[model samples]
Target: MDTMTYDYTEPVLSPKGQKMRDILADYITVVSHRLPDDVTKKLVELSKIEVDPLQRLIYDTMMENQMLAGKLKRPSCQDTGALQFFIKCGAKFPLLSELNAILKDAVYRATKQAPLRHNAVQTFDEFNTGMNIGDGIPSVFMQIVDDSADIEMYVYMAGGGCTLPGEAKVLMPGEGYEGVVRFVMDRMTSYGINACPPLLVGVGVGTSAETAALNSKLALMRRVDSVSPNKNAAKLEHLLEDGINHIGLGPQGFGGKASVMGVNVINTARHPSAIGVGVSTGCWSHRRGKINFDSDLNYDLPLNEGVEL
Candidate 1:
């Protein structure tokens, strides 16, 4: 019998490109171990309102887990999740052509350095790729911006538990916004507990299932405390937040005063006959990070504080 050995060498690149890749890899490692600033703050706020002994204990355990993850330099959760990047890049950015390859390489490096769990399994074939890189794994969705020379990215870990409750459907026009609320509430009642409350709920309204699904994910990228800018949408966010909190699923699904950190809604115009709504949830950890980079590779991580990568 022969044993196969794998090579984990970093990919060759221009000096600048190599630097950018290294930075991204380091950033991913940091993200794995640390909760974003907004998420941490929201969790603390929720902890204050919990009156149940068990729910309060759960919140305390969550905070301690975060502290130990950062202090010990390891992932906060066993499910590091499938990496996904949502990016808005300038058409004129220097590394636009190489960005895709750079991102893939960065994940590969992070998988080894962060020791991220192998979460990318090939569909139908049913085998974990082990590298966290498979066909379309470390999913990157990009939009090119005109007249700009910078890039903004949201890095998220869509864990199995959190992604389990995701759903989308098209409602009849006659159902109106009320229908949208009904769909979301149904999902929360049926599956929200599996996501690990207090969850950050993202709601998307659009013309079709795919659009709504994507927008729902984008909504997850927003800060937990953020509200939609559109007046009607903002009101819907508040309404959903109130309704979901009313579920009383509480922290870790034990009963308490609140069940969610916040609810975010993202909406766009839809066809006259149909309204599509999608839901995505982020667990209490809510490991979503935002980073921005200039054409020169100068970078800032707005969601993560005191992180230098």
Candidate 2:
């Protein structure tokens, strides 16, 4: 391939396009600062049932913290986490690559605009450059679909505080599916405290560790209280949820009626004799943002003209 350079001609953005980017940046900022809707609803419901004074106090503080963080336009947690953007791009869009770049720039910009803590770190050098960029960092997950011009993006703030506790294992062939459940229960009982509770437990079962891990991460991305379409899997989700909730780890690892907020199962086909399982939990403060845009640049959430981004 020969290198070719072209001079700039048309504007990269129209007035509406520029406004759309700013709006998106604002939405990401809001999601970063507030808990997801389902997680917040669970907290309110918990506060009502919470009999223990300390747990009630935590719930009240959490509810209050929501108000203060949004009003102040600051991140609810100091970690701020690595910015993970899940994007579904339209095939007809002319600016696919530009859109990705713009989003990444927005993440870096939001780190400063939201004044999110400097969480992205360079590996091997053991260094903190104070800016969020690192090699292969602030990753984006993208997929292109057919005949769709509208784009949907899910902005997730996957904090290290919650991710650090994730665990996965490969079970022996002799151990059946029961072995899988046992492994999950064991992992949750032992290390569930490491993740902030009440938690959103994402369980992935598949053919290998990497698949399992990825599936578990995907599981956490699902809406809380949404059950799997697969009957058996949905049942397992309900079972694991009840079991974990009974653990009494409660909010912030205290004791209460809501230990693990919800459990989601995302599984794939596994080898006949081998089973790989993974569990990743999101804390009650599941920081995720969403926005949709049409080809005309009309969009949603985290955007209002005159608002800070």
Candidate 3:
């Protein structure tokens, strides 16, 4: 193994960096109570747009859940789910060294302040680490996207009930993208009941199984109603959403209309002989938060942070 010792440089931060940490921690607390403003508005609109009376009732109840959760300062679901963060850090940010620590601290603080359930466990040892940190326990995925002076971070709470049925498949070149659709349809129909209904299904098409899996998770980081940036992908989004919703899994998979709130797809070029696909499904109770910060640590809150934590 090559070994070298170099003087480690510690990143210094403006006071804004410290303030940013508190803001982020507090953000987790607030969102844990109320659905993000954008999400609430979308849910309500979806409720109104839903043609089926059964689905409309589910939508109405979901809104009421949001209201009660916010008022009572309680988690909306008992599962609380596994926390994941998809972060894009800027290369020149003064507090790069501090970012990880900041996030870990924020998560810990949020757990206590929100009284978040203890979800982190020490594997093999079979122990709850309690602080929600273990080897990649919070499952943070970070990419240094550019030298620009801003960071975009998303906090996603993925529940086990929804992920229990996730899938990935490798198709032969002859199968093509049609294989992806087939796989999604199979999974949706086969195990749709395991996941909460009115899903926000995230699909990934990429070069490898791991890439596809990661992209599947990333696809869900997008807004529920937002279309993919790629035009072809956007078309696929509409097609998949319609196809799955047609199943009428309805709320809690109880059977009705509105099988999915949306379908979001993320794609990457693949090797000549392989087609990789994966899916990450989010229930209507999808709880994810987005916060953006400048190199100065000035946070641009997502439209969701409507209430004070």
Cα-based TM-score, every candidate: 0.96, 0.87, 0.89
For 114-233, candidate 3 gives per-residue lDDT tens digits of 878888766666667666555675677999988987888888777888887688877887998778889899999998778887777889999888898888889888888888889998
For residue 33, model 1's alpha carbon misses the true position, in angstroms, by 1.0
Assess candidate 1 and give its TM-score to the true structure. 0.96
Question: How good is model 2 by TM-score?
Answer: 0.87
Estimate every model's Cα lDDT from 0 to 1.
0.90, 0.77, 0.78
lDDT for each residue of candidate 1 in 1-309, tens digit (9 for 90 to 100): 543333345567788788888999998998898999999999999999877689889999999999999999899898999999999988888887778778889999999999899998878767677898887888999998676999999989899999999999999999999999999999999999999999899999999998899999999999999979999999999999999999999998998888888999999899999999999999998889888999888899999878886
TM-score order, best first, reads 1, 3, 2
- Which candidate has the top score in lDDT? 1
CA deviation > 4 Å runs, candidate 2: 1-21, 301-309
Candidate 3: how many backbone clashes?
A: 1
The lDDT, on a scale of 0 to 1, for candidate 1 is 0.90
State model 2's lDDT: 0.77
